[model samples]
Target: MADPSNELLASALSGEGQPSVVQLHGEESPQRCAELRWLYPAIKWWKALRLRGEEDLNGIDAYAASVDALLLDAWSPKQLGGTGHRLDPAWLERLEMRICRDLPWWLAGGISAEWVPTLVHQVSPFGLDASSRLEHSPGVKDLRRVEALVQAVRVNSGNRG
Candidate 1:
């Protein structure tokens, strides 16, 4: 849905829903996230930052504090999302040192269940955001695959600890 209406957002947040975090993607600004927080106080807000290259990270460290969490996705310079592109691991590494340590974050864009353990070891993010990887098609999540992925991550995390 394109920028949810305040009433709709409030209704969704107030319903009998599982505990969830609200992640806003598609070039959402900090101000937009702030407005979402004001409209739906119950849901945690994450701002998606699309990094096209290293230079795009310039002032992100300073901007990250206001967000509950940051979501790093591959920048397509042309599209909105689900471009099936992977972000540079080196750029992600630098970003981890710069922005993620102090706050909760998730890495999106072309992530798969197989990548979970390595990503957890490398970034130690609060979670992973799997869209296309868990989907049979855009907007259609494969429940079985998603469940398997959850189980795998739990097993892996337990082993690590």
Candidate 2:
């Protein structure tokens, strides 16, 4: 839901032991994330940034100003996310300096074990999401691929900034 009502968000968060972090997966717009944050002062909102053509990253700091974190993913017309698509590093290179310095972001979409070294070198995301890419089929992950990805992350962990 791109713009879930304040009433809906409050209702979801009403009960006891509310989750500390919530990912706005159904929401694709980055600008609306700040508005959601404004509605919920206590909860941590993780906004998924669906990167598309001409992503107006010049004002990203304003777009993601007070959010807890951001998730970088490729924008798909059919799928809101989990599309198994990779974001172009050339365009992402421009975002390295544009995103808010303290706001951590996780890289998603077409991340694979083999791409880790290059990803660590080109992008500075705080984390990576490889569930769909490391899977042999839907809901079943290839352990070898998962291991390779884990190993790759470990190998490149020290190389990141």
Top TM-score: which candidate number? 2
Model 1 C-alpha lDDT per residue in residues 67-151, reported as the tens digit of each score: 6888778887677567767777677667777774677777788777777666665556677777888888888999987987787
Off by over 4 Å in 2: 26-32, 54-56
List model 2 lDDT by residue over 1-161, tens digit each.
45567787788888988878888776545556767777777889887778775464555566567578878789889887778888888677788777777888898998898999998888888889777888889879999999999999998886854
> lDDT of candidate 2?
0.78
Lowest lDDT 10-mer window, candidate 1?
152-161
lDDT of 1 at 144: 86
Which residue pairs in model 1 clash with each other? none
Most accurate candidate by lDDT: 2
The true-structure Cα RMSD of candidate 2 reads 2.4
